[model samples]
Target: MDIHRFFPPHEGISLSDLSGLCGAELADPSQVDRKVTGIGSLSQAGEGEVTFAVSAKNLPDLAKCRAAAVFVTEKMAEHVPSDVAALIVAAPQSAFARAAAILVPDALKPLSFTSDTGISGAATIDPSARLEDGVVVEANAVIAAGVEIGAGSVIAAGAAIGPGTRIGRDCHIGHAATVQHALLGNNVVIHPGARIGQDGFGYVPGPRGLEKVPQIGRVIIQDQVEIGSGTTIDRGALDDTVIGEGTKIDNLVQIAHNVRIGRHCVIVAQVGIAGSATLGNGVMIGGAAGINGHVTIGDGAQIAALSGVAGDVPPGVRWGGQPARPMRGFLQDAAAANARAFGKKERKRGGED
Candidate 1:
């Protein structure tokens, strides 16, 4: 795949210079002058691109890689082809990530709907709203009364900022997105069509029928967070719903009331985190995973795709399947069940014969 479609390469850097930026050591000093033009995966990388291999299993694939340079660990150095330059690092993936940031800084910036730097004439900014210098409010966007937006933030076209909402510097509220009863930190990016701080599903069974419970808590989004398009983060019922710094949430994810996500968590598309669920730092929830309410996922835990998590997950473990047991245990149980089924089928066929 051509990475240029998502992040265009603007400038080329020598392998030596790139190594310095990413804390990688050049395997061969002679190849330091090799020019890297873009970044891609090991399978897709070609000439002038840089890629990385994180494990020994990936080392064999290096022979097929056509990249100008690759980031690898010391143990995998021997498998690197002679023609491909090797940049040794303790963590190949992390080094490649750093290199990408350095080479394509613009890729990190949020998409802007307009080039205009000030409030558009078509926008509806209340008289009581306070916008700092360099704040951009696009056409038809609504800034409610008592809203305070910091400098360099962009409220995109047709977006709505609720009354008393506080947005920090360099934030981007995408087109048609709505944010209410929220406090957003610097460099936060809320993508187009995202709905934040809406009332959660809260009700009590009363004598008459179901009684609605008031949702009065706010949503607090910390610095450098990116909430994806069409994602819904409901407001807390009592305490605040908090999204920690540097968390990247994919499109169509649902974060219910009082969900507390920790720093640098990766929540993939269609993941549903129920109310009061707490995810620890560096936790990764795979696509379509369901996290039950009040569950605590420990730091660095990984939930496999489509898994149903019904209880607390321990730190740094991989879990999968219904109820989300340890991956190894789940795999063992599946294999045993398969073997039993196969044996039973053979026995029944022999008896019929």
Candidate 2:
């Protein structure tokens, strides 16, 4: 797909300048004059563009690469086409990412939907609401009473801010997202359609049937957190639902009330973290995983995709499967199941031979 319509290529940068910007060692400083204006994948990169390769698997693409330069590891540098300048780095992809950020800075964050700066006139802001300088409230956005928005924050079109919520500096509240009973820290990015501070699933047996529990707690989102589009984070039952600094939550994730996620935790798409569950620092929960309520996952634990975590997990362990056992035990069960299913076929083949 042509992305130029949305994210245009940069003007130009010389090879030496790009190397320093991306922390890469230029193999041949003489080629410093070479300029690149765009970035693409190995196979698709053309003249005056940049790309990267990390392993021998990319050799076929690297052989025919037409980019002005290529980020590569020391081992892969030799295989790069002679026409392309090689930029060596320990982490080639990360170097390329830094280059992308430098070249396509706009792609890092969402641009103003209405293009109007400093509070659009069409936005409806309460008289009591406090907006600092450089806050951009786009068309049809609603700011409730007592809302406090810091400088350099953008409230996109149709987004709603509830009463008394505080948004910190440099935050982006995307189109149509709703924030209520929450306090957000600096550099938070709430993508389009994300539902924050909604009531959680809590009920109790009553005389009539089930009685709904009043969700009155707030959501505390720390700095540099990016919540994906369509994710829903429920308000706490009694305590604040806290998302730590730099935690990334993917699309369609359901974070229930009172959940505490530690710094830098990554919760992938469709993951459901039940109420009051606590995740320690650097924990990575894979796509579609279901972490049970009240369970504590230790620091650096990795839960595989489609796993059902019902109990506490120790630090730095990898787990997978239903009821989520240690990876080794899960693999053993899989191996036994495989043997059972294939044993009859093996016996039949032996008789035929």
Model 1 accuracy (lDDT, Cα): 0.93
Error of 2 at 231 (Å): 0.3
Clashing pairs in 2: none
| lDDT of candidates 1 onward, in order | 0.93, 0.94
- The C-alpha stretches of model 1 lying farther than 4 A from their native spots are 1-6, 56-61, 314-318, 345-353
lDDT of 1 at 211: 100
Clash counts for all predictions: 0, 0
TM-score, candidate number 1: 0.89
RMSD of each: 2.6, 1.7
Worst lDDT 10-window in candidate 1? 1-10
Best by lDDT: 2
lDDT of 1 at 201: 96
| lDDT digits (tens) for residues 253-323 of candidate 2 | 99999999999999999999999999999999999999999999999999999999999999999999999
